[model samples]
Every structure is written in C-alpha cells, then in structure tokens.
Target: MNDARDVTILGEPERSDRPARPGREGKGEIHLVHMYPREMSIYGDLGNTRCLAARIRRHGYAPVVHQHHPGDELPEQVHLLVGGGGQDSGQVTVEEDLARVGDRLRSLADDGVAMLMICGMYQLLGQTFTTVGGRQLPGLGLFDVTTLGGEERMIGPIVLSTDFGDVVGYENHSGATTRGAGQAPFGTVRHGRGNDGSDGTEGAITGHAIGSYLHGPILPANPAVADALIGWAAEASTGREFEPEPLDDEVARQARTRQIARLLG
Candidate 1:
C-alpha cells in the first residue's frame, strides 16, 4: 500500500475486540477491496470503485474500501474485489502478485464474494493470455477462457445487451478471448468487437465474478450491473435475502441512452 496514494481507512471502529467473521463486520458493513488500484486502474477504471462504494452506502450499509496493492494479503472479510486494466508491464507485475494469492481469490469467489475484473485483469483471470510476440502469460484460471493477442486493437464505444439491461461502455483490447465449454458470457455484443471479433460475446461471468473488456469505468454507465454486484456481495456477507432500495438512476440512464444512440448512429 502506497501511503501517499492509499490511506489507512478510518471507518467506524469495530464494536467488539474479538475477531469478526469473514465477510461480516460491525453493523453489517461491506468490505470492498480495490485491488492494485495504483498499478492497474488505467482508463478511468477507478471510477468503478467509487460507483460501487456509493451504491453500497445508499443501501444503508457501511462500505469500507481498501486500496490494496500487489503482494498485499487478501482480506479475510472482503465482500467484493474490483481490479482494472494495465499495460504489459503492469500485467506482468499483477500476474506475479495474483499468482501468489490466486488460491485465496478463487476461494473467496467460491465463498460468494463478487468480483469485477476489467481488461488486463479480465485477461489474467483466464487460463492463458498470449501476447502479440507469442509470449504466453499464465493466468489464475478463475474462468474457463483463454486470450490471444490480435494484430489490431479494438478501441471504441460499445453497447451490449445483458439479462439485466442494455449496458453501454467502451472497449479497448487487442486480445481475442475464447470461452471453454460451460463458460457463460456476461452479455452478447450488440455494437462492438467483444471478447473476440467473431463471437458475439462481450464478457464472461462465472459464479459471482464478471470479467469484461468494457471500460467506460462500466459501473457508472450501468447501474444495474453495479447493483447486481452489490446484491451478490450483500447476500454472501449476510447469508440472507437482501433487496436493496432502488436509487434514482435517471442520470445514468440518460447517459447510457445518449451513449448508445451516438455510438449506434
């Protein structure tokens, strides 16, 4: 943790001195860890963290954000993990750190922790990511997918239709991801080159984790996706049926509409 960029969060103190159980804190607080923000949060991806925190707070539960870096141990009580894209150098660094804690990440996912990994982080969640030079970067294998670098990078605004709603964002990646059998995509590509130029898929969803190349920060433009993630986290933390009070997302809705219209037109 860089002291300059990351602060020791002074959230509400614990009510008791005893160690709290994982995923549950004082007064039903949700712990969100922004993994390697300093290293991986390129292309406005940090906005997703802020958006999630705001939505979680609106749900009447305390939200504690940890700006966790590579090499930091995974928090035992994490309810969600958000990571962003990076360049090749940054991907190598992140890969090393993820390799160290990959087991813990997979374990947390199995325990119902929600995860949102974008671009480079998304690629690293798969089995392997082959670079343009034919160098293969080993991944965490959290999802049944593989990525191979393409000659041309795909960069533009995009609109995708999902079960939740129509999500609009921008995608910038050269890697073509192919899903293995049984792997499900987050949505079908509606206006952009998605996981691969040929496939109509835009992202991958396994359990509670979402891997996508979309990066208009994603959550700001798609409140439904943000709420869905928080819902999953809250349920996992409380082990109860949780229904969050809906927030007025008129601005986001309008923004998404404009984005889709402009991009599609």
Candidate 2:
C-alpha cells in the first residue's frame, strides 16, 4: 500500500454497466467520481471504491469510477460520486480544483444523487471548517456543517448505529464538525465524541448523501454500507432492486473475516 494510494483489492472494477432501460446492457452505468489527488490513500480510502465496485458486481451490476484529476473532464453520467479522506495539507493544496466542482457536486446531492464522503472529503463538502489559523474558509456548502479547530484526532476502532445495523469504522480527523439547525447528523458517535470535553463534534448527512469520519476503507469492512449505496443507485437510476449478498465461499468468508477483524481490532 503506497502512502499515496492504499487499495486492498477485495475485487476489481467491472467493465459492464447497468441498463438504461430495465435490462438493457450498458443502458445505465453507475459512475463514481473521486475528487482530490489519490486521496493520499489514507487508511484504505481506495478500498471504499474498490469495495463498492466489487459489491455491485456481486449483486449483478457494473460500476465505473472516474478518478478525476484537475482539468480532467467530468463523466457525462454519474449515479453515485464518492470522495475520501486525505491530509489537511493535501486537500488545501487542491482547494481551487475542488471548488471548481462545487456547483456540479451541489447539484448532484441536491437532486438526490447518492454519495458517500469520509473525513477530509466530508470537510470539503461543508459550508466551512475552522483551521488552526483561527480563520474560517469557505467550503462547498453541500452540507450544513463546519469543521472546527482541534489538536487531537480520533483514531482506532469506532462504533456507530445506522439503519443498517451496528456499523464499525475508524476515525482520524482533527477538524471537528458542527451541523446547522435542521441539518441531519450523518452518523452518531458510539465511543469518543471529541478530543476533549469542549466542542463535541459528530457526523452529518442529508438525504442519500452521507459524510462520515469512519475509515478502515469503510465499504470493505461493512458490505452492507457498500450494498446500501449500490442499491440506492440502482433503484434511483435504473429502477432495478439490488440486494448485497454476504460472502458465502469459505475462502471469501475467511478473507472477509480476517479483514474486518483487523479493522475492529
């Protein structure tokens, strides 16, 4: 795993795509657009998209992820867009590029487009996040939250409850978040809520859009999460229902168990 990109290869990205009409091949393809440079591959972020593609294929669907570099053309069709964590410095390095996609991103999320962003990516999707500079910088304003100053970051095993069930992932972010009034918290903190007793930060989300601090390449550890995303897209984009099947093969099961255990530990 390179520091610039960590991919745990649970599966590969598929070539085919969903039908535009009910069962038409290549009729509709769920696209995942990844912004930022290689996400700095912090703690298995690439695994999220890899797991997404794999889970979609396992459920009889195809996914194409467009890894967008600055000046790269955006895909014409996007069913779900994902952004993951990176260092604060890394994100700041590409702030202008990120802002360039602001209108497109806001439109997608506002139109009920399915999305999942974690940590650094989550911070980018907000209205503003405070930095150590004691000044607030403008964010994409996709969500009603602000990142606050914090010297400590939450890392290691994290537990949270979702409609799916008790979910698990890791946290590693110094930018604490605060949701606006009437804003929905993405995921709740089951363990450590803040670096100290002061400004306790938490998760936030709106509609099909989800932004969380959970790391550990979130999707691989929680297949339900990946499937939830795929199912949402399939239902929304193609009207075909998707159901995520748990790994049944001994080999696959063992591998999954080992990985999830590692994350949990």
Candidate 3:
C-alpha cells in the first residue's frame, strides 16, 4: 500500500458474519463510534460526529452515535470511528484506555471499518509518539507511522490535493509524523506544511483508515471525505452499495471556498 495511486477509495467489502442490529422494523442502522469525546475533543472536533450523523440520517437509515470514553466498553458492532486532537496531557489520559481497546480496534479495521482520526488521535493510531522532552508514548500501531514532537508547530489553514479532490482544513500540530515502510499518504500538501513540513504530504490513508492533522474539524469543510466514509460504512454493514440521498451542502461549500481563496492569497 506504499503507492496511494492504486489504493481503492473504499476498502474491501465486509465479510464479517456478525448479523446487523435491527433498526425500525428490520432496517439496518449504521453504528458510529466516537472515541474519546470527553478527552480528545478540545478542538470541538465533535462537530465531525454531528456532521456524520446528519449525513447518515439524511439517508433514511438511523445512525447511532456511541461515545466511547476512557474505561468505557467498546461496541462490538462498529461501522465507523471518528476521533480528534487533544492536548498532550489529554493524550496521556486516554493512553491506557486505548491500549485496552487496541485489539478490538485492529479487529474492526481488519473487518473493513472506516475510521477518521485527526492530530492527537492520529498520532495514537501509529506505532509511537515521542514528546519534545524525549518521552515516548505507545500507539495502536494500526498505521505504520511515528510522530516526533517539535518546538516549531505547524499551524495555519491548509490545502491538500488528493485523487478525490482538494481538501481544506486548519492544522495545528507540533508532532511531525513520518510514515514507516509500506505506508501511503492520503494527499500532497498544496498550501501548508504536512506530515513533517518537507514531504509535502498531509495524511495517511490505508484500507479505509485515515489519519490526518487537518481538523477545522474536517467534515464541515470537506463533505466528500465524510460521505466516502459513510458510504464505506454502509457497504461494510450490509455487503451492498450505500447510495446516500443528496443533501444541500451550500454552507459547507461556501466555507470551503472562502478558506481556499484565503489559503491561495
């Protein structure tokens, strides 16, 4: 998967034998797990969850939001997972909890669960995150990447080019990440520092799991990614294509357009 040019937009179809939970007279509901809402949402990234739920609801299928916190039991059936950035201290707070759920997360990933992880959470999805003081923290190792803390933080509006389209967001991070062998970036940087500020890359995307530093909460400004994730989740749930009804995204489009123009300026 080192070359992202050939990486499929949606990952493999679900082959899990697990039966779907019944929703309103046998309709299958999409199970969305929001990780660390209490601790990892300092950036108001919970908006991403809300945006996803709204999109799913527009499809006429219920999308249940499960907020998973430290020490809380994880849901056995998860279609998608969304997590966000936090302070270094907050990262430490969720460390043990993440370790406890590592096996389950990896299992879900293998079963084609789509995930959107940002900044602090993105670092935790990798092998390790080293602090500026040289303290090392363990990660889930789902993505073959490592983040090293730095004094010079990359903070600004960012524009990234992907095969899907140009994604815009605001990034603020000091832990520059480096992809390990066999890893592919989600996109190339067009207007801001990415990954390590030298590679021109912004995020990592592998088999339905996405790790990025972009967090203008992400979804409000980039609905395409959100829809892709939901589409993948719907497909993974029923072994069929999930065609969502079109919803007006004028506000989101306006926000994105303004951000892009400003970034260009």
Q: How do the residues 1-265 of candidate 3 rate in per-residue lDDT, one tens digit apiece?
A: 2211111111223211222233421335788988998789888687788778767766655676787988889987899999999988889999999999999999998887999999999999999999888889999988999999999999988999986688998889999999987899989998999999998898898899999999888987899999999989999887888867667789888988888888887
Whose lDDT is higher: candidate 2's or candidate 3's? 3
- The predicted structure with the larger lDDT, 1 or 3, is 3
The worst-scoring run of ten residues by lDDT in candidate 3 lies at 1-10
Q: lDDT rank, highest first?
A: 3, 1, 2
lDDT of 1 by residue, 1-265 (tens): 3111122332323222122234332336778998888778888998898787767766655677887777678776899999999887788777788889988888887876899999999999999999888889999888889999878899998889998899999999989999998899989988989989788898899989999999999998899999989988888777876658657889899999998888878
Candidate achieving the largest lDDT: 3
Give the C-alpha lDDT of model 2: 0.66
* Candidate models: Cα lDDT each: 0.82, 0.66, 0.83
TM-score between model 1 and native: 0.88
Ten-residue stretch with the least lDDT total in model 1: 1-10
Full ranking by TM-score = 1, 3, 2
